[model samples]
Target: MNAAATTHHHTSCLRCGRKLTSTKSVATGYGPTCTRKVKAAAKAEVVAQYKPHQVAKAEELIEQGGLIPLRGQIYLAVSSDGSQTYKTHRAACSCPAGIKGLHPCKHRIAAHILSLAA
Candidate 1:
């Protein structure tokens, strides 16, 4: 038996239970139409929806040394392991949480705050 065949990949869409046909749909568990809908909805969500509490958390982490401000408008927020560096800009970040779904992530908010203070 093939390893991929036994990997328990999605056979149907989780949202509507539609039978998955294409390989990409099977892998994502959502067909192109539904995927487009989801992406549209997500893109419509404004960055401000990230909430003030989440911004506070980002600030707290910065205070705790998880984020370090570098030269110019750039800042580096270290991951939990303190090994990987995530570059944060005034309105964006290199982190997945910053780019995925919504454009501005918590790291971006923190960077914005720092920018305003400066």
Candidate 2:
């Protein structure tokens, strides 16, 4: 037998960071499987941190149809036709919260908060 005829391959586990030397891959990531696991973990981390507020709001919106949440920390309700439903955006002293340029109008906030409650 010639030692030089055979070459050694090195592989590592993604989760545990352990060295492996198996030609066949395992679900735990001995070689090729390892890369996929690593990528999946990274993708999950990104998705977890992305649009945290939006995620929360999505749940709330389902609850209160009339009550809408806004970026200015105000709540409003509009008709199905998209007309102003309520008065006074809470974040500002003004009676109209809908006009506020905040990221979400009161209607949006109310919808988000209500959905979460539901």
Best by lDDT: 1
Candidate 2 regions exceeding 4 Å error are 1-50, 67-84, 87-97, 109-118
Give each prediction's root-mean-square deviation over alpha carbons.
Answer: 15.9, 21.9
The sequence of per-residue lDDT tens digits that candidate 1 reaches over residues 1-118 is 4321232346776445689898877765556775555444433442355575766665554444454546687877765444466888867788878768364666776566555443
TM-score of each prediction = 0.51, 0.22
The lDDT of each candidate is: 0.58, 0.38
lDDT of 2 by residue, 3-102 (tens): 2232323355423347756544332233445344433443444236336564344223222233333444354444334343453332322324335544
CA lDDT of 51 in candidate 1?
Answer: 72
> Where is model 1 more than 4 Å wrong at Cα?
1-50, 81-83, 101-103
